[model samples]
Target: MTVYAVVNTKGGVGKTTIAVHLATMLARAGQALLIDGDPQGSAASWAAWRRDGEFSPSPTTTVLLGKAVFNEGKALSQGFDNVVVDAGGRDNGGLRSALLLAQRAVIPVGASNLDAAAMTDLLTVVELAKDYNPDLDVRVLLNRVDPRTKDTAEMLEWLAEQNLAVMDARVCERVAFRRAIGEGATVQEINKKDQAAVSEIEALFKEITQ
Candidate 1:
């Protein structure tokens, strides 16, 4: 299974959004699993969104804490196309456990200096994760970006300078994203004909799976 942990030290950086969307994307493509590692259980809450009829095309998700991650590892070993873990900020034990199980670390950041600062700490955690798994593929995903601004270009350049791998896909700040999530719907299901949104998500999915 391809295990990816969505992480960030910064709050409100869209980490949970990325994790939830990516899980749906992977599930749409094929079989997958999603693990909620945050104590807040945002991911689990999202899964409940579907159970409560708040979402559509919901992906299978499990809320895991502490040693429950061990069972998650067994699931990954058995067979899964992908496993996406929604992780908490800082060096929380749950975060560390998720990192230990993940083959890749995905750090999501906003287009702001404060977001960038928080990402620095996340990078440190990525490096720490590497000590346990040398092949760990740590990458950055720019989220809530203003596609029309020069800040996007500047941010990408800045990330490169910091020696981080960044995906070509960028999620623009769109009302559709906010609306869909508020209604507990995946972008694909809510706006299947939304070409721009579809294109962005498809690009990110392709890059990660490839």
Candidate 2:
């Protein structure tokens, strides 16, 4: 019963995108549940779109904000192989509950100084969650990276200073991500094949799941 959560204190970091994609992939492999722990309800919205579109092998997605993410989410995990929670973009009870419930939490960091700077507050919250869930496996994932720029290297340096281990699979900025996510699909399900996006996301899925 492995539970994963994509969390970040700041908005626009692509937490829902990652969470939904991961949940989709996990559902393809086996029974999986996607909990929308955010009040924004982006994950729930994505699940609804997927339903209308009738995407094959879709995960069961439900909105479970606040402490329901901990209480109800745990109760709902029965018979599921995996659970992925999309934690909201703030210091909220939902986010903290996700931290408590998740066996692994992936924090997506964007490619900018401000994005890296925001980690201080988010990690502070994770630290507090660690007080209770001491075994939580926290991972820092680099998202929206520009392969053409020096930003990736700079962000690596900043992350090194923070002494946090970074995920090897980095998701570069690509139109495929926005297009697929907007349509309640992943790059793998899109009409046009973005091999790069597919590879990046698949690698991430493997890293966290394996």
Best by TM-score: 2
Give one digit per residue, the lDDT tens place, for model 1 in 90-199.
33666777778888878888887677666676677678878887898888889889867777777778898899998878888776676566656666767454667767
For model 1 the local lDDT of residue 157 reads 80
Clashing pairs in 2: none
Judged by whole-model lDDT over C-alpha atoms, candidate 1 comes out at 0.76
Clashes of 2: 0
Ten consecutive residues with minimal summed lDDT in candidate 1?
69-78
Each candidate structure's TM-score, on Cα atoms with residue i matched to residue i, is 0.88, 0.97
Q: Tell me the deviation in Å of residue 204 in model 1.
A: 0.6
Q: State model 2's lDDT.
A: 0.91
Residue 107 lDDT in candidate 1: 82
